[model samples]
Target: MLKILKYSFYEMIRSRWIFIYSGFYLIASMALLLLSNDISKVLISLTNIIIILTPLIGILFGTIYYYNSKEFIQLLMAQALSRWSIFTGMYLGLAAALCISILIGIGIPLIAYGVLGSAELSLFLLLITMACVLSIVFSLMAFLIALKFDDKVKGLSISIFVWLFFAIIYDGIFLLLLLGFKEYPLDKLTISMIVLNPIDLARILILMKLDMSAMMGYTGAVLSKFLGKNIGMIIISFSLLLWVILPLWTIRRVSMKKDF
Candidate 1:
């Protein structure tokens, strides 16, 4: 497993896409820093970008890497490697690679800007944590999704659709439901809906951390009333942790039963 992990990690690190991905974050972070001296505003802007882009890239890269590495996977299987090790190692390798890209891409500029000594440091760390968690959660999901389909085109299509649903459609649908039932109380429903979608969960977590939940309107009030800051943070953190575990566990199960 370790050997497989090392191979996959190094192989991905050598890829030009990883460089481009990391470079994108580095340039974006630098640009944000240059545009605004206000760390809070910059963090918010970054939160928005990371929430959307991280998962997109994570899942896309996972699916593509899965299909691209089929030949290597076959070779590993022929050598009697354990299915769990192969799948899990590959997943970790890909996820770790993405995390590194995120760290490098976002870390350098912030460090250079002396965020480490600033009061906003904790918030910056939280933002990075959420970004990396999203990367792992979505990439693991991509692997599980890819495993279900042998067709690369079909797999890629479903991957994109899954991302779209979670990142965009889910929120739109949630808003429509709220508008349709504006007269009725939706506190419980609103919380449940946000908890169900990882992207929404992440956005709420960051907004709360930013101390901007007042801008969240009724939903924010309900969250604060019901969960409070500490409890809400705990719940959100636990849920995000499950988002990582459940998918990876499913990947292991699926790989064991999969013919490939």
Candidate 2:
């Protein structure tokens, strides 16, 4: 397992796409920070961009890499290695590569700019938490595409739809619910709805860190009520952790049964 993981990690680091992805993230992060006059606004804009773009790129790049590496994987399979080892190694390798890139591209810059110290610890925790969630989400997405779809185009198409649903459509549905049930206990309803969408949860978590949850109105109030209290924050954090775990478990089951 160690050998497989090591090889997989090194292989990913050597890839041109990984470099390109990291370069793009670094440039964007720096540009956003340097261009903005307000630190809070810069953080908000960068956070939103990272939450949306990171997962999309991660999923797309990972799926493409897996499909493109089919020949290499087949050769490894022929060496009598266990399927689980190969799959786990590949998944971990891809995830680790992206995680490292995120740290370098975003984390380092934020620290260098002294942005890290200005934000509350809860905000930093939220940023790290979101990064973890993005990693899991995209890793699972890559696994599903690799295991189920033989065609690269089809796999990519599926990933795009999945990203769109989580990042855009889910928010649209939440808005509709808000409009339809304005008279209800909207605060609780807003919290419930945010919990249903990982992206929204992520957005809320970061915004809360920025002390910008007030901008969300009733939904913000619920988030504030939940995150403002110590125990409630813990519960919300654990719920986010569960989001990371469940999808990976599903991917593990699917990979195990997959013919590939």
Candidate 3:
């Protein structure tokens, strides 16, 4: 397991795309902070960009890496290594690499700009938590895509569409339902809706801390009223965890049965 992990990490570290992604994130972070007059605005903008880009990059890069490394994986499989070890190692290694890149690119800048102080601790926690969630979601998506589709284009398309659906279209559908049920108790309903979408939960978590939950309009107010308590927050956090774990477990199962 350790050997497989080390090999996977080395492969990611040496990839040109990793450097390019990190560079783009770093430049964007620096530019945002340098240009913004308000620290809060800077943080908000940075968080939004990170949330959008992190999962997309993670899924695309991870899937491509897995497909490109097919021969290497097969070579290792020819040895005595277990399939679980290989799969977990690759997943963990890729996740670690992406996490480190994000930490360096966005985390460092936020910290440097005094975004890690007590006043901003909750916000910082949200950022880190969202980053972890993004990595987990995308890593598993990549694995699933690789397992389900042999063509690189098909796998990559699946990843992008999945991201888009969850990130954008899912919210649109939720809004449509909310509009259709105008007389309902939206606060509770909004909480229930959040349970279905990790991206929405992430946005709520961060924006609530930023006191921008109101920007969500009526739904935001509803969530703020209901999810303002410690217990409410805990429940939502657990829901987010479920979002990460379920797909990952499914991916693991599929990978176990997958032929190299």
Tens-place lDDT per residue, model 1, 1-260, is 88889989999999999999999999999999999999888999999999999999999999999999998899999987788888878877898899999999998899999999998999999899989988998898899888999999999999999999999999999999999999998887898898888998888877877877688776777776766767766877788888888887788788888897
Which regions of candidate 3 fall more than 4 Å away from where they truly are? 214-218
Evaluate all candidate structures by whole-model CA lDDT and list the values in order: 0.90, 0.76, 0.80
Ten residues in a row with the worst lDDT in model 1? 224-233
Overall local distance difference test of candidate 2: 0.76
The number of clashing residue pairs in each candidate reads: 0, 0, 0
Clash pairs, model 3 backbone? none
Q: Residue 24's C-alpha lDDT in candidate 3?
A: 82
**Alpha-carbon error at 103 in model 2, in Å?**
0.9
- Give one digit per residue, the lDDT tens place, for model 2 in 37-89: 55567667768777888778877877887887787888888887887787778
Candidate 1 segments exceeding 4 Å error: 227-230
Candidate 2 error regions (>4 Å): 116-125
